[model samples]
Target: MRMSEKRAKMVMSQFKFLFFVLNTTGLYVSHESRDASLGFMVQRIRQMKFVGSVALLAFGHRLTASGFTTSPHLSPCSQIQRQFGHSITNPTRFEASVTQRSLSTKPLEFPENPSPFSTIKNGILTLHHRLRNEEVLQWRALAFSFFSSLFLFRHAIDVKLASLWTFLTTSSSLIPRIFRTDSYEWVLAVSAFFFYIHFFWYADVSVRKASEQGKVHPWRKYRLQDRFEADKHRRSVELKLRRNGEIPSQNELVKNYSEVTKQTGWNWKAWTCEVWVYVVPLLTWDILSPRRHRRLAAFGAPTTIQVLRDITCGLLLYDILFFTGHILMHKIPLIYRTIHAKHHQEPEVRAGDVVRLSMVEEVLEVGFSIIALNLLGAHPISRSIYNLIITFLLTELHCGFDFPWTPQNVVPFGLATGSRRHHFHHRNGKHYYQKFFFHVDRLFGFFQKDDGSLHGDSVKPNPHIPPAWQ
Candidate 1:
């Protein structure tokens, strides 16, 4: 009797342990299956073609098995004795028919071989990746650098060095016959002649800035944030004034514009002014020089011819250098940030602000003009015409006006240029540096889109101000 009782107790303990194992295993397997099913649902939702869908389903099955095996409760043959000791079924076996069926079914369909057009798609993707690389832009930089340098070297004639000597030696025979005449045509002609020689350097700034950096310096961000805040405060103040029946006048408008224009100060003026200062003495020295006879004979002509020649030659030099510099300025950072940044202070530039630039900036501009003139040494006459065309273009750019100019109906083109482009540079000195042409900026993905509105949507045209005050 005692031995039988001990045997029964041991048997009972074994059964309890088996039951615990089975319950644990079942819970674990169920949890795992649920997790795997969630994963499969996610994969199906993505609908990643046929192959990807199949792969995801396979992954789900593997993960479910892993989760089941890792669980302590999901053991096989647990609690079998208690569950079926007295009443055993025909066969005690566990088979996952549902899981097998789901795994076997195809959720996505695809052709064994993709269509022939697939080859074209693959080729396009390959080309796109290749074109996106930085190496592709290197040639652009090199081309810009070469052209800008060429223009700068050609047109850098130091005319100011002899102006003073020419004046003091008015009594000298070296003075041209044109100087004695009070003719307006002759004066206009002379002004036109030397205009290129004198202003070629001025127009070269755009090129030099462009070649140095594809975009403006990053300091532009700070400036922009500041502008936004300042504008906000100004508007608030203006609103308060209007509430008090106060109206802002023309002086107030000018003051507001002045503040906006102060982004870059006239640092270029310092250098240009110095150039002129020393140029006067140099001109005087040249005039008094004993070699004045030969020098005048070589370079001196009617003031009109000289003006025309200068204008034409100056622009030829300017155009090549300007375009090249504009391209490179966006490419090279050090050049753009430090050297080209000074001009960005003026968010809204005016005509007068064009010449009032820093010397460093001016030199870069002038350098390109000189290089361009050298390359176009075909003839003074041809060079002058080219230079004048380019000069007008540059002046138009510098003037901060975007007058609506529609092209011929057949062409259906409009003038895409604007001071707003330059204004943005001044607003944020670092982001949109490329000017004259938006090619480099657009290419590098730095170009800012214009909304054809001032200060973007920030400031609105308030027609009520005048009426409110009255």
Candidate 2:
């Protein structure tokens, strides 16, 4: 039963009990005959009261029209006898003034128009109600608050991430000339490996320490008092001046952490068996294979043609490996947590921290570049550019700024370009993975835009099912 109906029934039941008490106390006479006993009158009152109570509670509007009247006479015996023509010559009436007074004094009073404050307050009470009733207001607030933060952060991170491009664009140019000699090929290969290893370690450390707590872990509280004091002042000022927005809840942060752990774990495992055991050895074989057949049929060899070719192949292979690995990572829910999800731990990854990923993430990063170079037969320079671009793009998208890429740059390129797009993925991680090339994702129809905006949009809340990681 609906709550209102149940409440009405309970009220009616209580009214019937009160009627029985009143009937017994007020109507009892000295008579003890079967025709007119106190018990009989009490029972009659109960029957009439039940009818009156149900009429009032169940169909109160109809009862009000009927004057809440069950009969004309005070007792049913007198009313029934009169109706049957067995007359009580001068019957006692249920005093009209007393009855009217009792009827007029109802317990409940319903207003035609509710108080304005309560109308406003109740309208904002439920998530469903807020979304449905005050949609524009909610949306405007969301966009105004969050989109501003998302864009600025995205731009800053992208600019900082541009530094990695220097390595790719500069070093790849040297590989073309050096690959001609066997000694140079080995040197470049070994050098590239070591460089990647150093970067991997550095990134791992940085990522692991990305948290605010992690930053202050090594020092004593007293030693870090100066930093804390400075942060406190800055925070106080920000809180005073900052615009209000929906603060990310603890649940949201935990969700991001869980996503990152999944990504990192899978990436680590894949790199271990996939890279060292399989990929590296395969590339080495390709390099060694060319040595046995030095005499090409007719083509003239460039200075570092062999070395460049090998490096290019390695780079292309890296891309394929990582891209495929990413696809595989999402295929099985169990593997997703330890491998591909860890990169999403930070809701707003800084540009300086782009390379700061788990060891597994590093491996995926290298593998992605390798595939682009190896399989596509791209030059070492091109491969390097691709790697640099990937790094910057990843950081920029993850930075969580709405205007991160700017107007011209905002052409959606999967999850790697738009901050608004990727931020949604980070916020809700069950979907929105393995989407970097915007056209590709668009072709596949994989986009999921945020519903709420700070200015003029409404957010329809999805079923509040947390992501698989959470």
1-470: candidate 1 lDDT, tens digit per residue? 12243453465455456544543443334334544444443233223223332443343344444442223663222333234433223211211322333454422222234456998898988866754663323444454575566455434432432453256335445333333322322233324434533353343344235325544322222222224434554566666778889995544432331122122333355334644642454356545653424433444322333444655555544544565665466568887676555555455554444554455666666566646655643333334354445444544444443322200011112122334455455555543444344445555665554563335532111111211111
**Cα lDDT computed for each candidate against the true fold:** 0.42, 0.41
What would the TM-scores of all predictions be? Answer: 0.34, 0.31
Q: Which candidate is the best by lDDT?
A: 1
Q: Worst lDDT window (10 residues) for model 1?
A: 406-415
Measured by TM-score, the strongest candidate is 1
Superposition error at 371 for model 2 (Å): 2.4
